[model samples]
Target chain A: MSEVATPTQHAALAARVSDACRSAGMVGAPYPGAVAALDTLGYPTTRQERWRYTRVTRLLDVSPTAAAPHTAPPAVVSGLDALRFTFVAGQFVGGDTLDEGANGCFVGPVSVALARYPERLEAWSHSDFATKEWFAALQAAAPQDGVCILVPAGHKLERPVLAHHHMPAGVHVAQPRHLIHIGDNASAEAVLWSDTTAQSEGMMNAAITAAIGDGAHLSLEVVQDEPGTVHHMGHHHFTQGSNSKLTVRTATACAHWLRNDLHILQDGTHADSTFHGCYLPNGQQFVDHHTRIDHAHPDGQSDELYKGLAADKSTAVFNGKIMVHKDAQRIEAYQRNSNLLLGEQAAMYAKPELEIYADDVRCSHGCTTGQFDKEALFYLRSRGMTETAANNLLVQAFLAEVLDGFRPEIRDYVHSVYARRLGWS
Target chain B: MLKIDNLHARIGDTEILKGLSLELGAGEVHAIMGPNGSGKSTLASILAGRDDYEVTEGSITFDGVDLLELDATERAVAGIFLAFQYPVEIPGVSNINFLRTALNSIREQREEAPLSGKDFLAKVKACAQLVELDGKLRDRSVNEGFSGGEKKRNEVFQMAMLEPKLAVLDETDSGLDIDALRIVAHGVNSMRGADRSFLVITHYQRLLDHIVPDFVHVLAGGRIVHSGGKELALELEEKGYDWIVDAQPTEQA
Candidate 1:
């Protein structure tokens, strides 16, 4: 059994994390609630309901000696025609920086955007999760350089932005905070991809904060393909405006121990949101996805779907909460989660929480956990496919609904990652 | 092409096939008419290498090789096919893709090159036409939401594509209508050749009228008790199975 951390140990670890974040440099001044939130939330404990399945104590051992030298890794999805920005250890390394003076679009790092036009980012750069969640507070208090995408009103960014963050070999903490703001009637697309080297070991506490203005559109795809022994905590928060459309697709193709907290608040009427995610964890790895969407206004719509598989004693957890406010009538919300347990010892936890205060709302949720259909396996085998090929085909079929929502390039890349990790390629 | 001698098998503690024996030569069609629970489907499953049943005692030889040694995939690679009574509905996997994978897998195991796309599609077109299967069914998920007759036609279509040396039709005409039954029987008859053999397991004589067998055997109490030519089906259909079943030797049990 692993030893548990006491209150004093937790305090000491918090102090050490603070020192590490300070050494990694801060992004401008700390946000309004960062200091107070750090003192109040402190460190997350498994005793808390939200942290029950995740053991944050395992991350207390991360102690940094010194930051690794910055070097840009090979670009991912190179053939795709997109503006790419690379960051290593929470610092910008190389990429095309499209910075049109102040009022125009700015596609670069958050630190640069803060230094150049802090007023434009000051309103939406900080998320409410910073005050309510411990990890989010830690990230906001000492945030580092990450992707910053801003599109002015009535303008659409022609090319998608690919923000790639790499964690080099180290025993340090990297808190990279990404921010995006779309003006009224503007639109843009972006991809947040983070990967780590095999030898790297540390903590990646990242946050993505975005705000869509009225009549604006934004679509983002997030990919987490970390292979090293890194513990990742992601706090993603988005707010949609009236008549705005937001679509987010996340593919956790590979991870050791990762938890993603995603929240989207529909702050205006007729705002539409579609979010889908997929994950496959094998061996002794662990993955968790917690998502919530608030239908605060009438005529809003949201659709959520997540599917995954746990193999070889791995554990996966999914929690989705849909909240409808009192006056948010005529809203339709749907949530579904499906999981496959490939190994006898593998575990899966799924919960769907719906709090509908409105009388005229259409809300439904379904969660199912089952193993592969033995009859299907037999049918495939009787047709001459080996066990491996048959299993690969079934897994692909199971995840197609969620994975197909992503762009073709990203979909294939994520599929290859899963196939390689499971040794099905 | 296939031979079974005193094959005893069971599921869990209950014995299903007790000392069952049969033999089939190349270029011949043998129909095994049996009453309910006579282990006809059990024989088909064991021959296809389904692991649900255990062969307690006996030996099965396919083309001079120990058939029991091969797994389900290996059995298919060795030229054996079982048209299921209830074809599985596999969503998200198109029939074309499933057939391509199966065909390539068999070829790979047999040390042969995979069929080219042109040749494979041509074969699919010909085989589908043989069963009157349209392009829509060929491209849809494997038997997903298919009608009863469509599912049976799909089974025959798969048999035509695989072209197995020993084809076992386990109640292929169970849910099929007369026209569908005729189409399926025609698909099966067109594939018969000098190098191929078939084991047709059925209950009624209507299917036999469409695809006449060279010989007929009555399976009762998990063993073959009576044997005759195609005319036996007519006699049995007119007389019913009780005449042959009640006449079996009680000492055999």
Candidate 2:
């Protein structure tokens, strides 16, 4: 298939997108450069080697109309003792919904942080993926509204900071951006959830740039469950310093189609990174994850495990690569991707690659894609379980290896979501 | 009580059991001893509703219900259990969770309330002890990385938990050490009662020495050529199956 769109169409879409970004107050007001990069990337055609199997042109098919800003809806989540910020139709409506406990951190809006704590925006400018990845750069230049989080040095936030990027009830382009910084010896947890309203239709292209300073610990989770016609394009970039620990989990349960990009750079020695992804897509939905983890210094460690279940003609893709620099001796990197197809039409593609330049480093990658074991199915059924229960048992068990490591609160919530997705609720 | 009449079964056009017939009364245990490829395992599999074997001609009645009409899970709910010779290893399904799910499935069919978590745990611990299964292993995945003996013992452990009306043991004694065999035999013996019937199929008469079936049936070439009491097993063990196979032609004549 040829990606032969007229130049006029590209120029027109770029001009409109750039205008929206400037009107929404892009960080650097560099929409011209973003338009130039978008020209080279050209809307993620399947012709690209990395996107050979993932069909993403359908996401770009929707006409690019700027999402209309609306009044924030009443926040629905409670009981979580975290600073909660909600953006209504890609616009932050100003205050924290949850009761504020003063965690010595900022959670609300990028505009407020840029106006106040300008120091946090410094890390945003140096994102490892923004210049390298087209989607990251586009999101950086075209965010309608977003969240900025900053945890100061030597102080650990006792409460989590939660942000919700809410799209409104109509066809529109939604670009949401987030910048997070954890200073030296600081610790914090954050959650980014994007959901569209009923009858909503559009493309939600979002990006996150996070930096963990020396000796800092951070846990971040990203969840995308949009309603009808909402295609998701997400970019997550992480830069870790010496002795820092960062754990990230991306759980995609519901979406029309999703393409997620994750880039992790271990800039300093002794940094540790863990990436866990669980995707359960059913009934014509698509979920693809492309991740790259780079170990630039000695003693850096990274572990990645991704699990996916495709049912009812759904498709899932996982392409993960871990690279160890020549100087990064003694670094240990491990990656494994496991996929299960529930029906004949359902499909999964898992590709795991390891590039090790250091002779002394330990690195391994494994990819497995298969239907449920027939013997295991028969064994469960022979024990009196109905076919559905047996199938659910096996599916849950296949995913449990990854889910078991999630923190208790996240695990319980994720389990509930998964159960509902399995039609148990 | 269980009865099979004129059973003709085949796997992929190859008949495993040809015109075989057997019966077992309530409160009785029957042992079927046969040489290798004599269809001992096939009979057990057919009784448990394995789909690979096509029952060309047969009538199997279990507890007054037509067993052939039911699927494997339905047969399980109807109180039929088969102990696999090679128990499958399931990595993600925990032993305790699988047992509870299976037990609850059966209970649902019988219109019984599901066992509470506390009660089930108690029952599972007691049953695990019967087969000498380590308490810690119950929390692990079913049969995954278990020793050969442990897999066989796990089968009996699950049997004790399900409490089926009819239990078919197929080569359960295979790959077991003497001590593990003793433990398994003890578990089977503990589950035996007036209402339960068992079909113990083994290549060796040694397992019968422990279970002590009331009747012994010598199967040769897919047919029961001889039937007698427990002494028949010892005689076969001593004289060998060659004597029975050689005498079968003359006995039929």
Candidate 3:
């Protein structure tokens, strides 16, 4: 791979990428910096260390294009008693009224903020913390509308901020970017969901970045339950400050092909991060997850657990890596990937890697791939449960270990989604 | 009432129960004592409709219905129960949930409405006392992390709840101490009625000392070669199964 490109080709690519940025109304002219970097490094392929197990080029081969802004499609929305922000094709749609307690909170489209507060947009537009993911670069070039959440210092939001991204049919590509900045000692939770009823094959490039200040706590839940005709690519990056806690939980289902990249940077001492992910793929669907946790400072801890259940000719890939730098002594990091294969033709691949430069660090990584236990199935069947009931019960039990860790409302939502996926309801 | 006429069963190609026949009245308890590989447990499994056992010949009727035609659950609903020697442990499903599902399934088969949660809980608590199982154990997963005695007691508790017409104890005494055996026997005995029957299968006669079957049959080479009163169990325990097989007279050619 060479970091060189002709001037003509660079100019053409830069123009197309910049047009997307202008259409989305992103503030600041930081397009050239990202273009130069992409021309140098190019899009990451399967040959890269971090992308060895996940082949993202298959989905990214489609040229970057701007997704047209459209009205939010009607959906069977439940659990809407909390705060809600509806984003249509990366543009913020109208939202319901908020409570008096959320007066200082900032909600709605990112472009609104870019036009309203140019200085804040300039400062937070291009974060240096994002991974060099190709889709992330694409999102940065043509940033669409997304939610911008800001909780002031020492304030606690009683309700979660729910960001809903909707893409209509014929919109082949969407790049939605969300920026969340939490002040010191503030605590909040956010649930991000991407759903589309598009009959055509569309693509979504989503990027979310969160910064946790000192002694703040934030829980991020990302859910992707798009139709099978769509392709989804999501990137999540976060920085945990000193004494702050950040937890990211993701549940993805029903996509022709989907890729998710999560990066957590622990830059402050005594900060903690936890990443949990679950995916269920079926009907020729392919889902891949790649996660990285960087312990940049000493006395930081990170835990990662990603599990998958595949059936009906589906394939899933999980690659989780934890890096403990030389200065990250006394770091406690653990990573695990477990998969359950139901059908004979279904496949799952898992690779958990740990790189520790400090001798006193406690880091462990493990991976497992197998099918349901025959003995357990037989036991349940013998107890008067039908074969279908027995299998569903076991699968529910296996998935509950992960779902139980979520909030009650979110947990129930995930449970209903899983039940529908498993055809148990 | 039950009847097995010239029943033949095999696992793969090798036949285990060859021409085994037995009969039980409604209120009687029959003990089938055999050595290892003598097909005592096979009979219990075959009667309970375990899928692995293939029936090669003959037929069995339970209360005038074809027993062999029913699946495991159907047979269970038809009032046939098997107390597994080594009960399976389901980790996440609570014991109460498992029992209620099983009980309701059987009730549904009989065209009866399922019990309400409060009514079911009361019945379960009563049965739990009969089986001497703790209230805490009932809340845990089905047999998960339970002691050997606790698992057997849970099995008896399930039996008491289902209230089957014919109960098969398949080596239920294999791993029990004297106290567990007594509690398990009491659980079984409390379920006895004029309309219910029992088939006690054991390698040793220790369980028979408590269950006290009306008939004791010596099972040798897959067939019940000798049948006698309750004393037959004591005789076999003292003389061993080899003597029973040796005592069979060879046919004159």
Best by TM-score: 1
* Backbone clashes under 3 angstroms, per model: 0, 0, 1
Each prediction's Cα lDDT score?
A: 0.91, 0.81, 0.78
Tens-digit lDDT track for model 2 on A274-378? 999998888888889999999999998888999988888888889998888889999999899988887799988888777888899888888888888887877
TM-score of chain B of each: 0.98, 0.97, 0.97
- Per-prediction DockQ comes to 0.83, 0.72, 0.45
Could you tell me every candidate's TM-score relative to the true structure? 0.97, 0.93, 0.90
What local lDDT does model 1 show for residue A178? 92
TM-score of chain B of 2: 0.97
Best-to-worst order by lDDT is 1, 2, 3
Off by over 4 Å in 1: A1-5, B251-253
C-alpha RMSD over true interface residues, model 2:
0.9
Best by DockQ: 1
Deviation from native of the Cα of residue A155 in model 3, angstroms: 1.5
Scored by lDDT, model 2 comes in at: 0.81
- For model 3, what is the alpha-carbon lDDT of residue B137? 98
lDDT of 2 at B31: 95
Across B84-133, the per-residue lDDT of candidate 2 in tens digits comes to 99999999888998999999988987889999999998899899999989
Model 3 lDDT tens row, A1-425: 32333445544544554465567555334455555565555555556666655555455334444555567656434645657888776667767533223336565567666656545545444555232554566567667778877776787877888888886665356678888878789988888888877364557778888888889999988888777466788888888889899999998845668888888889798889988988888878889998889998899988888877998899898988888888998989988888899889998878777788888898988898988887667666556666666676777667766666776676677667766777765
Q: Counting only residues 3 or more apart in sequence or on different chains, how many pairs clash (N, Cα, C under 3 Å) in candidate 1?
A: 0
Pairs that collide, model 1: none
